[model samples]
Target: MEEEKMEAEDPNHNNWERRPESPPELPAPPEPAAPCRRRCDSSGGRALLGISGSTSKFLMNVITVDDYRSTYWPKLESAIDQLLTQSPGDYIPISYEQIYSCVYKCVCQQHSEQMYSDLMRKIACHLERVSQDLQVSSPAHYIEKFNLALGQYMGALQSIVPLFIYMNKFYIETKLNRDLKDDLIQLFTDHVADKHIYSLMPLLIEAQSTPFQVTPSTMASIVKGLHTLRPEWVQLAPTLFSKFIPNILPPAMESELQDYAAQDIKLQQELMQNGFARGDQSRKRAGDELAYNGASSCGSSQGYR
Candidate 1:
């Protein structure tokens, strides 16, 4: 066997590594993709007040406001229906955060007015349907059923109240001159509890026969809490001086006539009035029965007062 010849090399050469003829260069870091700008339609672009190009970028998944309205709104409606179900443990299938975010975006995009009107109409329609769907079997439980329906309806709407309030301040309070809560209550009362409230009206009125069960503070609260939405005049204080032909004044509050107006002037008249103070001697007054112009409270003031 022929002896293998050793190639000549310096001892230091072992320490030096041999380099490949051509080293593969690391690929240059890919140019950062241009800030993924999206071209949105007229309704979506930055030119529009609320929604900007940035919104489009963030909401890349959101096609357009109309698209959200068509798709997501229906999903929201489905969730609402689920909330309205009779099952006590029932919950909406859709994510609340996602729905709220969608609503927020829509409102922020200057689609607020349309969104507000649409929401109101949809809510009203649902309330009407709920009113019809409710079963009132026992006459005794009519109020109970009505209360339950109101509670369920309110629960279904509770999640959306924040969204409702967003437009309520701008649209309902300003343009409509109405309270959203009052409006919703009115709707429920009209559609669900109309008859119950009608029958229970006399119970709520403060009269000689029906003495106030609550304290002064509670009465104040009731007056403040129960704002009437109806057009008929509903005063917080029942006046004894009504049905004045020309000018009929209340009886003098003081024992004797203590006139604010001087007696000398032809137009001026001095008058004493009977005042009811916080611990007055005359706590009770006669003729307390409130005479309703119309017996039906179904057409009564929708508001609390």
Candidate 2:
């Protein structure tokens, strides 16, 4: 027994101890499957998905796969419904104030030049009706009441006139729809001739203040109106000249007393030109000095002097 135990304990004895069990091998990880690509319909199917052609095109050009479900896909669905709606205007869930706000926004915050033109044309048409109403009614009392209401409405919508004018001018300049431009210009001219330009002063002021890229049709009217009305400092020049400068203050009663403005813009322009020339000369002198110093650093003698 001692011998057997000694043999079992021997370092090189095969029977001394059971062979150590081989380590179990782990199974290889299953191959990752290729991701499935979603095939979206392209031929007007995207339109059915509620995406506007423009939005769809933009999405296709710029949107990524990860963002599709989150941003583009939802918008696409909404766009489809909006596009297919028979009357989106009717569907718009807004209050009366919101409607007015939208109208005002169309006038004041219009982004597209074409949209602005359309809005101005609509406003001009409304104004034409108002002018017609003013013309047909012979009673001063009725006219006064009507004028007050119309003035209030115009005042409320005043914020957008500049936008309308801008689009109108762009349309005219581009000759996009010359007939509309001619008609609108004629309408404005007639309104000025009728001496109703005063009523539009509030809107004119707001319009002039807009820094939009498009030029206001009101500018042409302003220049011509100014020449005709020769409004003093306080008085509003004809609506045509509403483009001369922003209306900082309302036409005062004092305007009725004066025939012309005291300050001559032409003279101011000349003074500005002189100042600009002086400034240019000063800058040139400074630049020359810098050049002279640079030359001096190189041990060169050349200079303006």
Candidate 3:
């Protein structure tokens, strides 16, 4: 066997070629791949933008000029510049939020109340057209969709009181495009004053009771709305908010209810304690069972011996 091994090791005896080491085998080079940008066709992107983008779009659509300039104008300018680079005034996938922001800025004027009436009408019409797309689309399409849902859901718990509170803050703190101010007033008169802003009034009050606070300006504005428009909305107002007048409301409100905060904290604490206690008991029981079994086995072994 040793002789055969020696024979095999003999350099000239077999397939051994005396050569310097060949280059290490390399993995085959990967082929070039196409770039996969996050995009859809013009209309498809627009359709997706509907659900995720509409709330921000709608907020932009309704905000006054000063509000836009202060809160959103810079972002709008950047989006527009990028949009122009892609396809002139009308980019195929221009977001609903972008379009609304641009239109609001374009038509707004500092002192005049006439510029936006026509524009507002156009916006309302456009919103109606996009309704089908917006209603059915997914929320993940836009970055702001979750924020919007969170806002709406939180608002719903308190009957959407926060929306009005936000509206009030923007209205008084910011000098609006006069046209938008008037338009909002008119729209509110038509929709809320004439009907059931008060129907949800009780729910709003209940939410307010939860320790959710309001800003001074915001609170004042709500009072103004209630005092001025209560009569118009009374007949249609739901039973809950009727207490708006009978009860002198609190001077302020919080962003979220206090009770909800308390409950959430309590639940978290209970879960943590219960989990810890259960785990501790389980470990102790297992240790005890193991010791008992060991003791019983040892006694049996001694008796057998």
Report the number of the highest-TM-score candidate: 1
Q: TM-score of each candidate?
A: 0.44, 0.25, 0.22
Arrange candidates by lDDT, highest first: which order? 1, 2, 3
Stretches of candidate 2 off by over 4 Å are 1-111, 158-305
| TM-score of candidate 3 against the unseen true structure | 0.22
lDDT of 3 by residue, 151-218 (tens): 22222223112212222223322435233334444444444333434333453455344332333343
lDDT of 1: 0.43
Index of the highest-lDDT prediction: 1
**Per-model CA lDDT versus the true structure:** 0.43, 0.36, 0.34
Error of 2 at 119 (Å): 1.5
On residues 1-305, what C-alpha lDDT tens digit does candidate 2 reach at each position?
Answer: 43343233232423222211111222211111111001111122453456576854443333334333343233323322332232312232212222222222222222224344444555455556766666565442332434343333333232233322433443334445553334544544555324554544444455444332114443444433434333452244333243344443344344432222222233335557546332444556777877864554332111100
Which candidate do you rate higher for lDDT, 1 or 2?
Answer: 1
Writing each residue's lDDT as its tens digit, candidate 1 over 1-305 gives 00011012112212323222111232211211122212211234455435575665564333357665675467556645655553433443444444444454444445556766676677678777766655444544443444456556655555555535545654567656887777776776566555344443343353212223433343333322233323222342332112111122334343222231121121112111223233542544443222222222212122111
Candidate that beats the other on TM-score, 2 or 3, i.e. the better one: 2
Score candidate 1 by TM-score against the native. 0.44
Best-to-worst TM-score order: 1, 2, 3
